[model samples]
Target: MKTSIATVCLSGTLEEKLKASAAAGFDGVEIFEPDFVASSLSPELVASTARDLGLTLDLYQPFRDFEGVGQEKLRQNLRRAAAKFDLMNRLGISTILLCSNVGTAVSADDALAVDQLGRLGDLAESYGVRVAYEALAWGRYVNDYEHAAAIVRAVDHPAIGHCLDSFHILSRGWDPAAIETIPADKIFFVQMADAPGLTMDLLSWSRHHRVFPGEGGFDLADFMGHLLRAGYDGPMSLEIFNDTFRRTDPFRTAVDAMRSLEWLQELACQALERDGREGSRMELSPLPTMVAPVGFNFVEIRADDHRLDQVRTTLHQLGFTDAGNHHSKPVELWSQGGARVIINRGDSTAGSPAVAALGFDVLDPELAAERAGRLLAPPVPRDRGAGDEQLLGVRAPDSSEIFFGRVGRGGVPAWVSEFGGSTEVTTDPLVTRVDHVNLAQSWEYFDAAVLFCTSVLALDPQPSLDVAAPTGLVRSQVMSTADGIVRLVLNLSPTGSADTAQHVAFASTDAIGAARRARERGLAFLPIGENYYEDLDSRFDLKPEFLEEIRELQLMYDRDERGEFLHFYTESLGSVFFEIVERRGGYRGYGATNAPVRLAAQHSRRPIVAAP
Candidate 1:
């Protein structure tokens, strides 16, 4: 599948944008209207440069509020569109994006809109250019793919086709299954993006907050699966509009965009295979296949002190039963329902408690390891013994060992079973498979970790950033295998000293529900301020009750054109915390706005040390 990006996604001079897109490995680009209007380069020059750089001009967008206008106004809009099409022809492009009439044309009747679109399609055909009809989430009458496709089908012109935008389709809550019904030939273009779900004014969010796929919470796999199943073999393009993404270094942003597409491609392939569709082998696999494909399998906590029993007791009260002690390892498993919590004694010599390692079950341990190895480095040999002990280990970029195995042999410990004494029979059921792993690494080892992940584990590297803080700038690098299952985030301390490894983020279906359940079980969490709610109310036009609930839960949030996201920081366990995310629609992203707030919260909770 050929991949492309919209020129508007990158922020810079036209030359820089073109250069960055080419460098990032895009086959083509959808030129945003602003980029084209602002460009100093002539259409012919731009076309020549794109050819020299081996990039195609996929589409020019977006002519908005063009249809259903008064005759004179419509004529003028048509003339303008014609000029744009001429320029596109000069630039050797063949497609133009026509956003459904929003504000001004929303009230126009469907028949009028169809007639106007048919005229535009006829005009486009005159120039040998195709018109891609897109449904804007905030569009007037046409806001969903089904509605937009109806218009396209009603026009019944060869020049008119539908553009499948994952963001718009998902953000509007349109069923992804609809793609299966549309004729593949009519799928002229495809746009993909991910954003964290948020409660904000959709217009404002669309203008300033979009995330790359995999960074947000959209089931792109399902969307892509539907597209592929329909035999829609069109150029896959990315058109993201995010304030943070625009402000970030253009080059790095381009690289990350490419990484996201690669991740999505892998995900699409896997989903297709699972659904019994024919596809090629995966480029990389980041997950182990030992357990069921959902929920937290186990939580690993590494501590420097010998508080395994204390920690175990805490887990016990939360309804967890001890699995069994490993004869050769210094680890013990505790379980509740399908969730397993592994307590690692790796740092027992030190007084601080930290998370050491995490394990996930996979369908095939060796294949998963091999796939992971291709993205980073070869897997390291792990010891295996008789009776349910079969497992393989791989080193992530952050130097943490990820163990993949089937169910262990031994039964639950008698003490734990007896202590928990209940009519409930314990059964070893596979929980949620491993989603991704985050790591906190020291500055000195940052480069080494990156190398390890790339050369040893064979994961793709994302652009690194140095976040400025009161103490100093914290540099971090994130690497993920092509399959999108394994993720390692390596963070370096600003002080240039060895830093403790801490913090983790787990994926979940419902954060609000999970938070409530965790609270009921006595898990402590930091409280969000009412001020955030006030800001949320003013920033987003959401209902008062929903805003109240979010603020009451201390959930941090932000939205983009794609979708919304929610976040919360845990109490200080050093500088570490967990992010529980629940994606609505197609949003995918960590709540970036909450980062500073969370950091400040952590700073406030830091223990005051006395001078010796």
Candidate 2:
């Protein structure tokens, strides 16, 4: 299937959009009327530029509110349609998007709509062009796609066809199975968009919250499957109205848009295969085989060379022993059971230690790298010296590096030898492995990070939660594997302040004992006020001994129908901190109920950030 995107989905001039689309490997573009009208180039120059860039002008959109009017208004609309048809010829585009009437509808009669659309189609045929009628979700009448399809069938003109949009159909809770009822020849074009499950008005939701597929709550795979079964093989173009995309870098937005389509096609292809069908006439290419990571092999922290004492001391107090230092770089590796953390003192331009990279255990490193490359995620830059292992890596949406670690027969990573780690530990370590990592993200990269995690790392996103802060709401999204070996928490702060710290949580069989050991080492814990403990005791009616111990250690506790969770946070050293968590009896949450309290504690100690 061909891939296309509307010019309005990106930022910058029309020419820049065209170039970026081509760079991102899009086959065509829909010339959004406003973008074209706002450009200084004439129709001829625009057509020539697209031709030189090897792009087809797929559609000209969107002529609105042309039906359900009185005679004088109908005449005026036909004249307007004629002028647009002429402009389409000059631009070498055959299809024009004619959205259903919203504000200009005077009657609820389908007969009026059919007659007006037939006349418009007759004029379109005379000019050798086509009209792709779309059903806006909030249109006054003909909002239902099936209703618009019935109108198109009644019109029965050669130049008239219905444009199927996934957003409008799914958002309205319409039955997409009705799509197959319409003949393949009557479907002109297709548009794809995904949005969160919002409860606002349809028009406002469509305008402000639309996101690329896989980044939101829509079941796009099922929608695409129904379309494939309907036998309408056309361009899968993106028509997004997102506030962030419009303000972002056009080139980055275009690449992210392209990735969504690719991921969607793969999803639909898998759907077809599951139904025991080889595939449709549409040539949907399957992506590289997705293999979720087994577990975290290592995590790298970058800090200033002179500011490493606190980080080292904290790790030691948490029961991590110094494994070794990198042979070629100023990086040290520390280990506790299966968990490994790297302290890099080479680059600290940010003035604080932050998560710089992550390594995941994969069955086939090269194959995983190939899959990421196909999704347009660039490989993590490497600076290897002689006799070093061939390490493969890629960059995440927030610029963190991801390395694919290959293990030997004993499940030990082969690259650990490059850092001079000993063959075995001299003593037993306290924590077992990394449970999860909470990564703070800028608002611009939150959605992109979610999609990137889903497509590249093969992580499934769990439900999102809103953690209230004094400043505003902090949106938290967790992405992890089915068995919960690997978890990533992406936090969208209200201010997206760079000073917001990220934390690495380690798993321990006895979090209470681990907290006691760290406290014995004179480690400072993030204090939980007495008020929080008193409220916790009242809420859960916890045992007196357990309550007193937790209160003494500043450990947060949460219980549910399934199980209980015990966790504690360390005092922050710049933009980094540590956490030890114990999940008893399959507790799967991150203690979100206590997040507000934790947030308040951290905020009070943070430096006051003045208004810019």
Quick one: best lDDT, which candidate? Answer: 2
TM-score of each: 0.56, 0.97
Candidate 1's displacement at residue 356, Å, is 14
lDDT (C-alpha) at residue 357 in model 2: 94
Clashes of each: 38, 2
Cα lDDT computed for each candidate against the true fold? 0.67, 0.90
lDDT of 1 at 412: 27
RMSD of each: 13.3, 1.7
TM-score, candidate 2, is: 0.97
lDDT score, candidate 2, position 343:
92
Worst 10 residues of 2 by lDDT: 273-282
Residue range 281-343, candidate 1, lDDT tens digits: 223333322222122235577665555555655554334567666655666666654455666
Model 1 Cα shift for residue 192 (angstroms): 0.8
Give the Cα error of residue 133 in candidate 2, in Å. Answer: 0.8
Worst 10 residues of 1 by lDDT: 411-420
Total clashes for model 2: 2
